[model samples]
Target: MTTVRLPLFPLNSVLFPGLVLPLNVFEERYRAMMRELLKTPEGEPRRFAVVAIRDGHEVASTAPGMPDPTAVPELGPTAGFGADPARAFHGVGCVADAATIRERSGGAFEVLATGTRRVRLLSVDATGPFLTAELELLPEEPGDGSGALSEGVLRAFRQYQKRLAGARERTLSPGTDLPDEPSVVSYLVAAAMMLDIPTKQRLLQAPDTASRLRDELRLLRSETAIIRHLPSLPAAELTRGPTSMN
Candidate 1:
């Protein structure tokens, strides 16, 4: 039963555990978050929750303590996107570990945060200098499954990667094989694919690692079929072998 109250960063991108992304913190609210987090001792957790936007964009605006007279975000689920905070954001999100927070010469901040784990937003409030939320840890249930299914998923993913590389005439997928952990592997694949917003969100909110893998496998096969039969691509554009559409 671990619960935390921390600042939130609502972006248009999804974060997955074991994967990291670079962020440019220019908003006054987030800049303040960086400053406060830096004050913590060396061993404390320096993190914030990242919720992907459902139907909005990230824009610079005013927050508490800032002298700027810009728009103040509403206090609710859509709160992060100037949304209601209660209805604007998804229920599940990822906690980003601020591995590095550097002050920029432009009065903003540059942060590198890696997704640490999944969390469910229980509530949010505007009672502080920044948007704060109470989130509880969401853990994946242990699944009993055979290795063969895992292997099949991997095979389909590799085939999909090869076809994509062929079309680009260059490699885009991972250079090395994914790890044995199903969750990690699924995220890695999702990151590489140019999936739509809804599909990516579904992957992020999957109940368990096995479920994530199965969904990824289906996507991989579907994509492979699309590329394999598209007559526009030159036969030489394939990386390894063309997948059979039938």
Candidate 2:
């Protein structure tokens, strides 16, 4: 049960390991986070934990003249630690490695990162410029029959992609080749599907590779069937990948 402390970034979408995450960081709190991360010497991994905000608690930009959206509420002196700030975020998240953090003209940052590994949130601290948390690094386990499951998921995923293309009248991946590894297949399918946040979060929290692939298999078949019956889909509905936010 190895644990590490890192800055936290809560987004409206779920992040799966091995997926690219591009962010438009414009908020003051996140600008400060970028500055802190920049202090790290170059050539080292600049990392942060990205957790999905729970339903009804979406992070939004503060309106002009309004209080800072990232500010922690001032609890009374008698307020106990039992008041969990982590409640606003899902328990499972992915650690992102920032490969490029470019400071913009207005002190904001443009970050290009990739999800490296999964983690479990232990606790969150908000009494700082930005949120930080203690995370327990989760291991990638290839569970029972994951190899077989991967084959099934890949087949279903191809069908799913074809159905999606037919519904939207555009090829989803063009000529992009799918991977063969079980764990990679699971994460790729999880990220590529147009599922809801809770479903993707559940896939991220699955106990092992086989479990994630199993869920993806079910989802691909179900979603493909639904898509096959649909007359057409809106272009917006065909959008995939992480939701880029500022």
Candidate 3:
């Protein structure tokens, strides 16, 4: 596996390969990161690792360079996040390269990052302008049952969607129309789900495509069962998507 020292941005969400993470970057450290990223000879990559924050607030108000501290708005809750920032990051995270940038009127800017591959974070260096990490590529384990596995995952996923629509008592997108490759399908569905960090991280760290598919099937089955029994569930609660805040 290859290793590279890359900038790390911690978020409250988990990203899977093939997913797109849209972010609003206002923190000073991340702003400096963007400046350094665009300065390579041919232009350094707009790539970085988006790790899930374990315990700390998304941004510490008192971090260096702060103008003034304000009351942090209450986020709904912190689920699946760990307790220690040092060892809190999920070991496996997606490598994302900025696909688009929209500078806002304020100092904050919007960025679209497309997830590529999983990387294992070896160590983190926080002394830089932004968090930097020694990341090694985490390759998926190739398995033989891709054909059967993909079909199974797709079937279960479809049924889950249908059941979800029933629970919502409304029409929803009936299809994800995912790719045929098992690994891609696995990541796509994992991205589509509204899972917490630990679950997403576990799926990302699944040893092989088949294992990931199986785990997804179980999750779909369990969720579908709940949908079937419940009187109703809010569409917002049951529905899942790829886009998330950073």
Candidate 4:
């Protein structure tokens, strides 16, 4: 297999292809990295790899060098998020392309990236300002009937949408047309529904669509069942649209 080296983004959330993620670039190194990446070929992979930071926020100071800082916690049945040798989660990831950029009030940069394909993490050479690593491209699986969710999941999804619609003060429910397959349904559901960062990252790290859907289905079921007792809506509700959310 061909090997590729890419700049690293160790985030609290997982990214998937055909998905959009927003990144806040405030660190000097990552801001510099962004400037450099902006100069690269656009139509090419425009590739970058992401790993979860186990115990630190900034990689320059906190992330340890050799043993890969213990292992990132796995949210699925397997250690999906912590698989990448260069990172916490290795096998699954989105090869994203920079889509848009905006400057925030505090001089931080906000960027939108659309995930293009999945890549496998092989090794890392953490000798630079940001993390860099060798990556193995993973073959895309033709999602057939893998982890299909039950009708209860669907019903919960609908209520989740309604709750989100009410929170955003917008009647929009684009995700209401979610496909039957577990993968598509899960991503769409997670994208539209309000969930915690760690939970969402877990969904991102799920090995297959079926697993992702199952995890999301569980979360939705729990949330729907406890909606009445929730103290407040998800703090993420303030910004909850595709372009606006992340």
Candidate 5:
């Protein structure tokens, strides 16, 4: 595996390739990382890996701790996620390169980054305060081009978009016009905007375009069905902020 050291950001949101994510770099370690990157020659990639934090929060809480459990269950199921946070994440993750970084009114930076490729998270270090990792590049498949999206698939996506639009209108009229080229980027942005962070992460980790599209089509259809069946469902239920990727 090819390994590179990366400065990491732990956030509640997930980022996807071809999508934009704005970061407020207030922390001292991250600001230092950004300054180091900015000084580098243009076109030199200042790449980093994104990973979901298994531990609850970086800053430990001082609130009164809860008492230990009274008793372990007699026949508990095999240990799951909570059993071992350390072993939770697969080696897989995305490698993103900075597109833009601007200093905000405050001392922090307002940065925009776009995903360029996928990387495997080989190991991580919290040697300092912020997270850092060692990652390996994940090679793209042979047919990574947009050609796999058949005419039938495109038509289905168009239909899905239409339904999605209708659903949006019923709630608050979000203005996400369907793109002319329903390209892979388009699908990625759509999935990024429409789904939650965990769901979007799943989409990013999907092996190929076909599987990602299938999952998005399924989600869009499901949301449309929900709107159709429960027309009375609160519009608030359907409201989600636009993805930074857009």
Candidate 6:
């Protein structure tokens, strides 16, 4: 297994491969991370690892009245690991490539990135200005019957979109066509569904394409049924798709 060290950006939400991730980099630690990434020569992939914070862990706010930014918890899972940065986050994460990094006023950054691949977090270093982690790039495996699973998932996904749109009184994507490739379908469905952080994280950590698709299939059916029975859902519950990170 190959291991490489890269900057880490912990978030409250899960990131799936191929999904778009936009970030507002205002925290000093993250701003420092952006500066370090900017030093990479143009044309090279400027990448970082994005790990989801475990439930009960919060990303510190930089608002004037909030807790001091320096007093924030280290970028790692806090529930079981305590102060161990390496064990602070879930084991699996997605590596993101920063396609655009724009500097805003006050040295902050507006970054537009895309999740490129899954990785296994090996260890985290918190002694730097920003968190950096040693990661093992995880290969995408097309497990047995993935092709067949893809078709079923696609059908369920369409139904899910329809049900969700009905709940929201609008088309979710109107005419957007979903991809047929198993891994693409899996990631697309995982990113599109209105699921909790733990559910999405599980999807991201699935052993293979077929496994992820299978879980998504079950979730879609359950969600579609719930939506069907409910007369209406709140606007927030109906919201789905890629979300921005701050």
Candidate achieving the largest lDDT: 2
Model 6 residue 240 lDDT? 45
Per-residue accuracy of model 3 over 72-188 as CA lDDT, tens digit each:
222111212223344867787889988776667766667888888889889877555567889999888757787798888888877776676664444344454458888898998
After the best TM-score superposition of candidate 3, give how far the Cα of residue 31 lies from its true spot, in angstroms.
Answer: 1.4
| Count of clashing pairs, candidate 6 | 3
Order the candidate numbers by TM-score, best to worst: 6, 2, 3, 1, 5, 4
> Compared with the true structure, what per-residue lDDT tens digits does model 1 show for residues 5-94?
878876666777877767776656767778988997999879899876566443323232233234333332233355455455677889
Worst 10-residue lDDT window, candidate 5 = 70-79
Clashing pairs in 2: none
- Report the C-alpha lDDT of model 4 over 51-127, residue by residue, as the tens digit: 55443332223322221222222221111223333435434455667776666777557788877656767776545
Give a tens-digit lDDT track for model 2, residues 106-149: 77688999999999999888778777999999999999999999
Q: What's the lDDT for all of these models? A: 0.69, 0.80, 0.70, 0.57, 0.54, 0.80
Q: Which stretches of candidate 4 lie over 4 Å from their true place?
A: 1-3, 55-92, 101-109, 140-154, 164-182, 196-198, 231-246
Q: Which stretches of candidate 2 lie over 4 Å from their true place?
A: 61-83, 167-176, 233-243
Tell me model 5's lDDT, rounded to 2 decimals.
0.54
Whose lDDT is higher: candidate 3's or candidate 4's? 3
Q: Per-residue alpha-carbon lDDT of model 5 for 1-246, expressed as tens digits?
A: 667888765444555565556665654556666777688687898777665434343221212222113212221211122343224454456667888888777656777787667777776665553457777777654234444443334555444444555545443223444343434543454543456656766766777665666666667567556645543433333334332210
Q: How close is candidate 1 to the true structure, as a TM-score?
A: 0.79
Q: How many backbone collisions does model 3 have?
A: 1
Order of quality (lDDT):
2, 6, 3, 1, 4, 5
Clashes of each: 12, 0, 1, 5, 2, 3
